[model samples]
Target: MRLIRGMAGAVLLAGTGLAVHPAHAQQPGFHRHDVLQHDLSVPGREVVQVRVDFDPGAVSVKHSHPGEEIAYVLEGTLEYEIEGKPPVTLQAGQGLFIPAGANHVARNVGKGKASELATYVVRKGRPIFVVAD
Candidate 1:
């Protein structure tokens, strides 16, 4: 179907570089799905939503968002760490917000795959995510 093909292309593009870092290759079973993107009613703003899946023991490198980010766990458990705060474990039905420009990392700490829905309110034409040293 057309929709399936489009989704597959989006996923491939997102994984190629739009949302993933080269270092991500070291993390097995990590996948990012570009769910939707739309220009916000507010000028110069856009809302992008993605579904991120992390297999057991997978971890992401530190990164920052170009704008505010909100994430909700859909399944399993995620260990999230943001600069200046202690890491927190979020289970299904829980969510967290990350202020713009804050460095953060996420890891799958559960026995199964962890999935989360992430929404970002970002500046138009800017990369939604940036790798942080």
Candidate 2:
């Protein structure tokens, strides 16, 4: 019931001239809700925003984007591990920056549900996300 409601806003880009089907592990406990997106002034660049919710113990597996991402914690604790960097656990109102092409993952380390607002400034015509090995 919650998963269905949470998934109602999961919008994926289609007309960006790229067919991006991220082969990410589909976890039922995790959901993504796209909030907004726009073409940046920079040619070939665009910005997108999404709200991600994580059930207790839910995990967003390793993945990478074409550009950069800013993540703000909105609810519970989330641990982010960006490649080549130490793992950081963020609480409500905290934030983290992820460099372009850096592989990363997020885990809900809190007892309750966790949510984060992620904004990405990424290259247009490229996959917003790619599953990482």
Candidate 3:
């Protein structure tokens, strides 16, 4: 139920291209939202631009990725915990990269909402996520 609402909200925001991030006006050709995406047109390779809007006290479900993930925080602060890795905090303007198969989850521990832009290089014809703990 939570996933559905979260995804729906994300979809709506993405479609409307709302205030995706404080820096949205600076980057051209990019969509804005709580979670917006702009796919990079790389032939034979998948490169997608993703934005994550995080509300205070919100934590995402634990999940694992099948591809390499790179992210940059555009606003607010995010707290991340990955399997076997010490938790880290990413403030606005920070970045991170997760290797393939790494289990991880993120939470917005800041006072306000947060946002991030991520890119993934995934295998073709397969989904990218698998729930994990």
Candidate 4:
């Protein structure tokens, strides 16, 4: 049902990361689902992928990840506000990169539900979702 290979290659080109603050991990109609996990050739490194869905008008609040993330839009539009950088808005089939430890918020800017394929290259055994403000 899946192809595990090449995920690391995707991560190599994917460095942007984003997360939802703990308080809003389950905000109304907002959801995150782990898609898969694969161990990287680098010792103590791993790749984790998740599918995050946002309802219209839903906002992630400021948050961060334990490592780099490459968020590719799967549907709808999302606006990303990352610390120290201008806010970026992405549409379906587009993507945005968020650096590790960067505080950011991902909001559903479209009238319909928005979602992303958030893939991360992170340290083994570390939580991908980290608290942020």
Which parts of model 4 are misplaced by more than 4 Å? 1-25
Candidate 1 yields a Cα-based lDDT of 0.78
Q: After superposition, how far is residue 57 of candidate 2 from its true place, in Å?
A: 0.3
lDDT of 1 at 2: 53
Lowest summed lDDT window (length 10), candidate 1: 18-27
TM-score of each: 0.81, 0.81, 0.68, 0.78
Q: For model 2, how does the per-residue alpha-carbon lDDT over 20-133 read when each residue is reduced to its tens digit? A: 443333446777675877889999999888788889998765777899999999999999999988999999999999999999889999999999998999998776866565
**Comparison by TM-score, 1 against 3, better one:** 1
Clash count per candidate: 0, 0, 1, 4
Q: Which prediction has more favorable lDDT, 1 or 3?
A: 1
lDDT for predicted candidate 3 compared with the true structure: 0.64
Candidate 1 lDDT by residue in tens digits, 4-66: 433433332255344333323323467877688888999999888888888899877677788
Candidate 4 worst ten-residue window by lDDT: 1-10
Off by over 4 Å in 2: 1-26
Total backbone clashes of candidate 1, pairs 3 or more residues apart or in separate chains: 0
* Stretches > 4 Å off in candidate 1: 1-13, 16-27
Q: Candidate 3 or 4, higher TM-score?
A: 4
